[model samples]
Target: MPSDLLAPALPTAQLPAHLVASSTRYVETGLRGAANTVRAYAGDWKRFTSWCALHRLESLPAPVEALAGFLTELADAGKKVATIQRHAAAIAKAHALAGHDSPTADKKVKVLLKGIAREKKTRIKQAAAFTLASFKRTIRSIDVSTPTGLRNRALLLLGFTGAFRRSELEALNIEDLAFDEEGLVVSLDKSKTNQLGQAEEKAIFYSPDPALCPIRSLQAWLRVLDRTEGCVFVSLRKHQHLTTRRMTTKYINLIVQQYLGAPYTAHSLRASFVTVSKLHGADDSKVMNQTKHKTSAMIRRYTRLDNVRQHNAAKELGL
Candidate 1:
C-alpha cells in the first residue's frame, strides 16, 4: 500500500469521563453529525480562546459582560455580523460544555439569527436566473478538446445534474460514482443539509441524456482520464492512481472562475440545474427529491421567475 493510503492510528489519551460518555452516546444514538460542522465549531472555539488570552482573561468562566465586550470588539474591528454570530455561538457552546450557563447565549443567538434572516432577504433582492438557451450558449462557448476543458465540462455536468453544492462537489469520490444501464448514480455521505440540519445520509442519481453535449463530453473525459478506482476528479498530474489528497472547495471555485468568467461559480451550475428543470415543467416535489433538499422553501430559491418566463415565451412563439 502507498504511504498516503495508510490510515493513521488513533492517539492514546486520557479523556474526561463525560467526554467518553458523550462519544459513546453519539455513536450508539447514530447522532454522529457532519465532520465539517464539528471542525467549524472547533475553529470558532479556538478563535474565542485567542480573544480571551489577548484580554488577559483567566478562564472562559468569565462573566457574560466579558463575552459581550469581546463581541463588541469584533464588531468595532469591522467583522461582518454573520462572523460575529458564529463567534458567539462557538463561545456559548464551549461555556455550556464547561458546565457554565452562558449569560450572553440567548442575546447572541437572537442577534445572529436576525443577521441570517436579513442576509436571506438580501439574496431575494437579486435578479431572477437565466434561461436554458443562455445556459446552453455558455456551455457551447467552451472548447472541450483540451484536458482542462474536459475536466470543466465534467465538473459542470455533474454539478448541474446532481444540484451539488461546492463542498459536495469537492467531497465526491470515484467509489461513490455508480454507473448503471439507466444512468449515473452519485452517493454522497455529506452535504449542506447534513452539516446544517444534521439529517440522515442521502445520495442522488443523475440520468444524463445520451444526446446532451455536456453528458457526451463528460463520458469522453472519463474514458480519457481512466480514474475508475478512486476520486472521480483529480489534479492535472500524470499519476493513474488516486491518492488520498482530495479537491477542496477553493479549487472548485477557482476552476469555475477560470473557465466561465466572473459571477459564474460552482454554485451557478446548481442554480442552472434547478432553473432549467423547473422550466421544463418538473414539479416542485420531484425537483426537491432530485436535489436532495429537505424543504420546498429552500428549493424555491433555485426556481427563478426569469427562467420560467423565458421558457414560456419560447414555447408561445414556437421558437
Candidate 2:
C-alpha cells in the first residue's frame, strides 16, 4: 500500500537565526507578527536579492536608486502594482534593517517610490470573490462517481469551507481532522502564518454548514480512499493509489484552472469566505478570526461592501 501523501509536520521549534536573518534582521530576534506575513516578507526579500544579484548590483545593501530601478523593471515586465509594492516593502525592510533608511526617504529615492506607489495604486485591481453559483458550477462540472471525482469534490469543498490556501490544503493530514458536537477541528501544523507572533503552534477549527457541508464530502472520500491513516487528500491514477505524497500547491492551481476556467486561485476561496461572510452580516472580528487577518483594513478589501450595500439599498427602495 502506498503510504498516504502528506508533508511531514514542521516542529514548533524556533527557526534558524541565519535563515531568518537572510531575509530581515528582525528574524534574528524573532518574528513578532503573523506567520503568513513573515513568510511572505521573507520570500519577497529573497526575490529582491535574486533580482539585485542578476543585475550585478554592487551590494545587497544598495541605495534606493537600485530599488527604484528594480520596481520599474518589475512593472515593465507587467507584474501587478500590488505585487511590485510587496516586493518594494520587503526589500525596503531588509535594507532598513541593514542600517539603511528607505530609499524613498532620500530625496531622489523618495521621488521614485512616490511615483511607483501612485502608478501601481491605479493599476491594481481588487481580486474577485467566489460565489455559491461559481462553487456549484465548478463542482457540478466534476464527475464525482469515480475516485478521482470523489477526491476533487472533497478537495474543492474543503478548500472553500476551510478557506484553505493551496499550501495548507497540501499539508492536510487525516489526523489533523477531529469531529465533535460543535463541528470539525482542523489542526494545521504549518500555514502561511504558522510562525508569526510567539511562533507557537496552534490549530484552527472549521465549522461548515451541515446541510451543504464540505466535511460530508470528506467523509465520503475517507470511505473509498485506500490509505485512510495518512493524508486526507491523495492523487489517484486509474483507481490505483499512487505515492502518498501530499498534493502540491501547483496541483491545486491546476485544479482551480480545470474547474473555474481561469482567473481564480486557491486564495480566492479564502477571499470568498470573507466576502460572503461580510455579505451575510458576519462581524469584522468574527470574519478576521476565520480569515486569520491581522487588521480591519485588510479585511475591508476582501469584503465588497459597496456592491452588497447597493443591492440591499435597491431592495429597500423597491419596498
Task: Return the top candidate by TM-score.
Answer: 2
Candidate 1 CA-lDDT value: 0.62
Q: Model 1: what TM-score?
A: 0.71
lDDT of 2 by residue, 268-288 (tens): 777777777777778888876
Write down the lDDT of every candidate, Cα atoms only. 0.62, 0.66
RMSD (CA, Å), each prediction: 7.5, 8.0
Task: Give the clashing pairs for model 1.
Answer: 174-231
**Worst lDDT window (10 residues) for model 1?**
1-10
Query: What are the runs in model 2 whose C-alpha is more than 4 Å off?
Result: 1-26, 29-57, 96-107, 194-211, 226-229, 238-240, 305-311, 317-319
Question: Model 1, which residues run further than 4 Å from truth?
Answer: 1-33, 96-100, 108-131, 195-214, 237-245, 302-319
Error of 2 at 24 (Å): 12
- Over 1-319, each residue of candidate 1 has an lDDT whose tens digit, in order, gives 1112112222215767657656544432232235554567677777766777888874356566567667777766766666777677666655555546665556764674465546544233332345556656666666766766677778876676677888887777767766655556666675766544443332334435433444466677677767666666666655334344666777887887675666676777777777888768888887786678868887677766653445565657765
